[model samples]
Target chain A: MTITILFFWLSLAGTAVFAVSGALQALRNDMDIVGVSFIACVTGVGGGTMRDLLLGATPVAWVNDPTDIIVCVTFAGLTVVANKQIIGRRLDLLLWADAVGMALFAVLGAAKAQQYGAHPLTVILFGAMSATFGGIVRDVICNEIPVLFRKEIYITAALIGGVTLLLLPVGLDDAFKLSIAVVVSFTVRACSIVYGWSLPKYG
Target chain B: MTITILFFWLSLAGTAVFAVSGALQALRNDMDIVGVSFIACVTGVGGGTMRDLLLGATPVAWVNDPTDIIVCVTFAGLTVVANKQIIGRRLDLLLWADAVGMALFAVLGAAKAQQYGAHPLTVILFGAMSATFGGIVRDVICNEIPVLFRKEIYITAALIGGVTLLLLPVGLDDAFKLSIAVVVSFTVRACSIVYGWSLPKYG
Candidate 1:
C-alpha cells in the first residue's frame, strides 16, 4: 500500500517534468497553445500509454486516472504562460528537473514490468522505453530527429538503473529498490549534463 | 506461391508509394538528403515494423529482407534527386497516390493479421494500424497534427475494406479478395477527398 502511494507520487512528478519539457520545446518552436498542450500530453504520458496497450493492461493509466491529464494540462498551461520568464532564467533548472523525471519514470517502468512478470531483458527494455519514448514522440512532433539517436546518454542511464534494480537483492522492499534505481539514473544523467558526457558518435 | 508473389508485389508498390509521400513531405519541409531518406524509411516501413513488433513476428519485415532497405534507400535518393522536376505542380496527384498506398497497405495488414489467427476485430485494427501508422509517424516528424485525427474517413475506409475482405466467401481466390479490398478502400478515400467527406465532428 505504501509502495503504491510512493509510485503514484513518482509518476505524478515525472509527468509534470515531462509536460514542462514538452512545453518548453513547443515554445522554442513557436507553437500555439493547442500545439503546446498536445505536445505536453504526448510527452507526459505517451510512453506509458504505449506500454499499457502493448501489455494489454486495461483502463490505461491516464484513462483510469484523470488526474494525470489534469496534471499535464496544468503544467503545460503554466509553462506556456511563463514561457519567456522561465526560459530566460531557469533553463538549467528545467533541464535538471527533466532528468529527474526521466529517472523516476524509468524506474517505475521497470517496476511495473517486473510486477507483470517480464524477464530481466524485457524489464530493462521497458524501463528504457518508458524513460525515452516520451522524448522521442516530443522530438518527432517538433519536426526533429529523436534525441535518443543523437544526444546525451539518456536511454543508457535508464538501462543502467533498470539493470541495477534487477540485480538488487530479492529481499529488498519495492520502495527501496525503486529509490535506488531512481538515484542511479538521476546521478548518471545529471553528471552527463554537468560534465559534457555523451555517447560515442559513429558515422 | 502465386498468392505470395502477388502479395509481395502489392506490398512493394505500397512501400514505394509511401516512400514518395515521405520524400515529398521532407522536400516540403526543406530537409537535407539524409533527413529525406530517414523520413521515407520511417513513413514507408514504420507501420509494418510496429505490427511485427507487437505481434512478435520474428526478424521483422525489412530486417529479414535486406532488399527492402535497398528499395527504400533507392526510392528516397531518387526522390531527392528528382523532386523539384517531378513534384513541381502535382500536389493533388501525390495525395491520390498516398490514398492508393494506404488502401493497399491496409488490405495487406488485414491479410497478415488473419494469417496470424487474430480475431476479426483485431485483424481489422491491425489493418488500419498498418495502413495509417506510417503516415502518423510522418506527420509527427513533420511537426503536424496527424491527419488521422483530422481525417475521420481515412481509418474508416481501411476498416470497411478489412471487413469486406474478412466477410468475403472463403472459396474466392486471395488475389480476388485483395483486389476487391484495395478497390473498395481506394474508392472510398478518393471520393472522400473529392467530396470533402469527413466524420461527424463532436463539439
Candidate 2:
C-alpha cells in the first residue's frame, strides 16, 4: 500500500510537469487560454488514458479520480495567467522540467504495465508511450507532426530506462529501481537536448 | 465468407470516400501536394488503426493487407494531383462524400467489434469510434477541436446506427441490417448538414 501511494504521488507530479510543457507549447503557438488549458490536459493524461483503455481497465483513471483533472486544470490555468511574467526568457528551464516529467512517467508506465502482466516488450513500449505520447498529443493538437516521428531520441531514451528497470534484480527495492530509471532517462534527455543529439534519418 | 467480403468491399469504398474528404480539407487549408496526400492517408485509415491496436490484433489491418495501403495511397495521390482544379469549388460535395464514408465506417467498426466478442455497448462505442475517430485525427492534425465534438449529430447518429444493428433479430441476414444502419446514419448526417441542425447547449 505504501509503495502504491508513493507511485501515485510520483505519477501526479509527472502529470503536472507534462501539463506545464504542454501549456508552454500552446503559449508559444499563440493559442488562447482555453486552448492552452485543453492542450495541457490532453498532453498530460492522454497516454495513460490510452494505455488504460487498451488494457481494458474500467472507469479510466481520471474519470474515477477527479484529482488528476483538478491538478491539470490548476496548473494550466496558472500557466496561462502568468504566461508572460512567469515563463519569460526561460525556455531552457521548461525543457529540463519536461524531461524530468518524461522520466517519471516512463518509469510509472513501465511499472504499471508490469503489474498488469504485459510482456517485457509491451512494457517497454508503454514506457516510451508514457514518456512521449503527451508531446505527440500536444503536437497533433497544435497541427504539427509528432516529434517522436521526427529526428528525436525521445522514445529511445524512454525505452532504455524501462529496460533498465525490468532487468533490475527481482529482490531489489522498488524505489531504488524507480530512481535509477528516472535518473537515467532525465540524464539522457538533458544531454540530447544540450548537444542536439538525434537519431539518424532514413533517406 | 460472403458477408466478410461484403464488409471488406464496403470498408474499402468508405476509405476511398474518406481520402477524398481529407484531400479536400488539405486543399482548403492550402497545403502542398505531399501534405494533402499525407492527410488523406491518415483520414482514410486512422480509425481502423486505433481500433485494431485496442483490440490487440497483430499486424494491423493495413499492414496485413498491402492492398489497403495501396488503395489509400493511390486515392491520396490522385486527389493531390486533381485537388486544385477539381476539389477547390466543391465543399458541399466533399461533405456529402464524407457522410457516406462515416456511415460505412461506423457500421463496419461495430461489426468488427462484435466479431471480437465485445459487449453490445462496447460494440456500439466501437462503431461510433470508427465513424468519428478518423475525423478527430484529421481535425487534430488540422489544429481544430474534433468536428465530431462540435458537430452534435455526427457521433450520435453513428451510435444510433450501431445500436440499430445490434438490436436486429437473431439469425437475421447481415446484409439487411448493415444496409439499414448505413442508410440511417448517412441520412441523419446529410440532413443535419443541410438544415444546420445542432444540439442545444446551455450556458
Candidate 3:
C-alpha cells in the first residue's frame, strides 16, 4: 500500500535524524570517528532495540534488515563533515526533526506491541519508551542525566499519541489512525518547544 | 554435574553482587526507593541482556525465569537497610565479588556465543562485553563515566578469560576449562586492584 511506503520513508528519516543527533553529541564529547559512528548507530536503534528485546523479538529490526544501520552510519558521516560549518542552531533544527521521528516511532512501537498482544498499559509504555529511550542512552553514554528524566514534554507527547491510537475506532484504517496519532504527537511536541513547556520538578 | 551446579550458584552470586552494587550506587545518588530497585535490576542483568539481545537470543534469560529479578529486588532491599551500617569497606568487598562475577560472565558469555556458532573473534568480544557491560550501564545510568572505559584492567581481564577459554583443549572437561578460565580472569583482576594496574592513557 502507498501508506506503508510512506511510513517506511518516515521511519528512515527518523532514524537519520536520531543518528545525526547522536553523532553531534559524540563530536561534542571529543570522540574519535569510530566512537561517533558507534554512538550514532546505538542512538538510532536503541529505543526499538530495547522494545524488541523486552518483547522477545529476536534479531531485532536493525539486525535483520541493516538498512537502518546504513542510514545511521551515512548520517553520522554527514554530521561529522558538517560539524564545523554549522553551530548554535543546528541542535534546534535537529530537535524539530527529532520530534517528527519520535512521533512516528511512538505509534510504530505501540502498534507493534499491540500486535504481539501485550497489555494495553504495556503498549503505551512501549510507545513512550521507544520514542525516548535512544535519547536517554545517548545522554547516559555521555555521562549526563537523561534528558527524558529532566524537564520535558517529550514522553507526554508520545503517551498522547499512543492513547489516541488505542482509543481510535477499530473501523478506521490502520494507516489513517497512525497518521492521526503522529500528527497529534508532533503538534504537542512542537507547541512545547515553541512555548518552552516543561513538567513540574520534584521538590 | 557438580560443576554445572557450581556455575548455577556462582551465576546467582554474581547477580546478587551486581544488584547490591547498583543499589549502593543508587543510594549514593540519593535515588528514591523505586529508582534504587530499578537500577539494581538493570545492573544485575544488564550485561547478559545485552549479550542475549545482540545474539538474537529470544525471551532473554531473566524474562524466562524471574528468579534473577527476585534476587535483585531482595538484595536491593537489603542494601537499603544496610546502607548506614556498612560504610567505607563495603565498596571494596563488593569489588572483589564483582571480579568473580565478571570472570564467570566472561566464560559463560563466550561459551554461549560459541554454542550459537558466532565467529571466534565475536565470541571473545561477547565474553568481555557480557562481563563489563552491566557495570557500564550502571555507571551510565548514574551519570558517571563507565569504569570500564576509565583507567582499569577490567575488560582486559575479561578478554584474557575469553581467550583462555577459547584456547583450552576441547578434550578437557567443560567444567574444568570454565573453572580454569574463571581463576585466570579473577587473578588478573585481583592483581590489578592490589597493584593499581591500568592501561596507558592516550597522550
Give the winner by lDDT. Answer: 3
Error of 3 at A74 (Å): 2.5
- Model 3: how far residue B135 lies from native, Å: 3.2
Clashes of 3: 0
Best by TM-score: 3
TM-score of chain B of each: 0.92, 0.91, 0.90
Expressed as tens digits, the lDDT of each residue in B123-173 for candidate 1 is 775677688788888887787656654443677787777888998999999
Tell me the TM-score of each prediction against the true structure.
0.58, 0.59, 0.61
Error of 3 at A81 (Å): 1.9
**What is the C-alpha lDDT profile of model 3 across B95-140, one tens digit per residue?**
7757877888888888777777766665776687688788778887
For model 3, the interface Cα RMSD in angstroms equals 5.7
Pairwise TM-score winner, candidates 2 and 3: 3
Comparing 1 and 3 on lDDT, the stronger one = 3
**Where is model 3 chain B poorest over a 10-residue stretch in terms of lDDT?**
B144-153
Which residue pairs clash within candidate 1? none
> Candidates' DockQ values?
0.06, 0.07, 0.15
Badly placed stretches (over 4 Å) of model 2 are A1-46, A49-108, A113-203, B77-88, B149-151
